[model samples]
Target: MKIFNRVAAAIAAVACLSVGGAIAQSQAPLVVGSTLSLTGPLSATAMTHKLVGEIYVDQLNARGGLLGRKVEWLVKDDQSKPDLARTLYEQLITSDKVDLLIGPYGTGTILSAMGVAQRYNKVIVNHTLGIPSLSKYEMAFPSWSLGSDPGNTVPNTVFDAVAASPKPPKTVAIVTSKFPSIHFMSLGAREVAKKRGLQEVLFLEWDFGNRDFGPIAARIKDAKPDMIWVGDIALEGNMLLDAMKKIDYVPPIHFHTYPAPGPMSKSPDGNLALSMSIFEEHAPFTNNKVATDFIQIYHERTTKANMPDIAVEVQAAASYAAWQILEAGVRGANSFDDKAIAAWIRKNRVNTIYGQVRFDGPGNFGDDMMKVKQVQNGKWQMVWPTQFAAPGAKLQVR
Candidate 1:
């Protein structure tokens, strides 16, 4: 009986120490602050951004932390409101007094926080803001296949893919939103279609928040377009796909500029949708140790937490890549000073899971910013710009 009691006490002590260790890590003093839409329409995306940020923080902590101090991450909910995002940035800068700042998840939120960032002289590494308009600001650094590049390249990529097919598509139709970014993408697609000598069988621009895609999809099917392109984000893409399914209008080729999480992620009938975006599973790492290690770590951590999907999110890859950029700057400069880190980043080629990148003066990748990926046989493959494609990655149009 005494031996049994001793064993129980020893087990209790071990459990207590494990819990205490986690608490101590959570209480670390080096705070990194950012705003996110944690409780609104964009909450799912925000969760992914937060998960990747936490993963990087955990990895850094495991390495004995940055500059001899543990990192604490503070993310305040912006509720997907631009006004709230501005207010949150003000609070993060003045009240929270975060040692570093990273850009939030959307173009509007990042744009709203710019004034605060400028006033406080904070250097922000943009994780998700893709609007080309935002590229003018020197303080915000965009990471991902860039929101701007897709508007131009998505159409060209789709055309190139179809043109290469055994049965080339000669007619194209486009359904897009009037939202500036998406609209611009539609115009770019139109231009690419013209350049490729494909007849414009149908073209429609729906107002923002116009939810019914049935009418548009029906018209596109009636037109019998050889290829169809949808220039909206993920939610609209899913709606369009569902509408198309109801009408039994599956085009030989379909493309989306935003690469939303639905229809394009995985389909039971062998994923056929093509999208232009940065994906973790398909990113061009080229045997780089830093990127491969980051990918492996992300998978291991997310799997252990029972949230493996987060590791596959494009935002997750980009958010962690932002941390990698900042981490390199912090360690290279050996200081937490934002200005010094920014200066170091401007001059140095930071290695990240995304690839080696050196920011142009305006915080955009000077070259090779985005890729064309297709979901073939339930796996995402980089199928464009042959130089950056993964091994065994090939394009197949069904």
Candidate 2:
């Protein structure tokens, strides 16, 4: 009788240990992968993205992570090269066996790496990089592709601003890099300009890696446009401004696809304070509690003295939002199978820092929420949406 009782107690102890081990395995960390351009022409923007991603992962881990599993982000520098991005993505999917994939800053990189993502059947939660065709692909694959479509958001903002302008420019000059990302931006911007009754005087494309804009400057001077639209990355955008100053070709309105007002606003000539598009999804100047909280956290982590500029702020928020959506989908599906999570993300409306987030049937995050922000008195002020307008934005001419 005594031997039997001892045997029963040992069996109970073994069962409890087995259950605890299973629980620990279930709560193990999930690994995620990223390919970013950390050392090339787009390095500055990529660095900002990296900082934001790091901060977000840190914060998420601090909060006990998502779905009972801490996230481990494995980031690789692609140096802004599409081929390198593809290689890194291949390695992450095969060797690292990452559970999720996110980022490849520019459109060209994203498009190139996406082929590998398709082959591996991985879920891609893009942070930035706007390729219009991605929407079409998502419709066919259903469980393969996903991301925000900046192409629609940017053009809509530009056209709306022009349509409402008190004295809209009659002639416009569109300048963009030949990179795949800016190509779409230029296409969208030109379409918007034409629809708004603005004549496109000069449509110029330059290689992003090229440092000299002298010829472009001369061409802009010759075109004598009433407005200038820039479709380049932040660094190239800054160089263009410098060239504009040197040429003294000041158009009535200077619009940029993204908010690059940081370097431009701080320029000795202050050439960037003209007109720009602040995607409502990425606008940091809003009174939204999420925006405020993100800004505070970003400032605390980075070396920047002031709050992160609009681009950095947007990148961080968007990256964090993507992570949250990824988590939601993972939890809702109750499985890490890429196909299941992708389907879940497509069907469900995710509440994120940005706002109520839901992808269209094609897996494209639609554009009803983009805010158009303008610079006034050396500050970025929300000019559209009326609900979040800054004090000086109300008086400024569109």
lDDT of 1 by residue, 1-398 (tens): 99999999999999999999987865557888898877765565676677778878998999988888888889999997788999999999888889888888866788777768888888888776655655665655666645346555667766776676667888888889765566777898898788879899999988755779899878988999887888776357767777888887777888776644433565543266777655546435535666666677767776776652533545666788888888888899898888888778777887666666777634455444566667766666667666655577766666
Over 1-398, each residue of candidate 2 has an lDDT whose tens digit, in order, gives 99999999999999999999999889878888988888987776676677777777887788888777899999999988889999999999899988888756777777767778877778777665566555344411211122355555566666566556676678889998877767786887888778768899999998768789878878988998877787777567677767867887665667765434466555654432444432232334445775666666666666453533543334455556767777777788988888888888777788777567667634465444555566555555566656645553542442
* TM of each candidate vs. truth: 0.83, 0.84
Look at candidate 2 and give me any clashing residue pairs. Answer: 280-370, 280-371
RMSD of 1: 8.8
| Model 1 whole-model lDDT (C-alpha atoms) | 0.73
Candidate that would win on TM-score: 2
TM-score of 1: 0.83
Go through the candidates in order and give the C-alpha RMSD of each one to the true structure: 8.8, 4.2
lDDT of 1 at 296: 79
Among the numbered candidates, top lDDT falls to 1
Q: How displaced is residue 188 in candidate 1, in Å?
A: 2.3
- Please list the residue runs of candidate 1 whose C-alpha ends up more than 4 Å from where it truly belongs after superposition: 1-28, 145-154, 207-210, 279-286, 300-313, 361-364, 387-393
| Model 2's TM-score against the true structure | 0.84
Question: Ten-residue segment with the worst summed lDDT in candidate 2?
Answer: 138-147
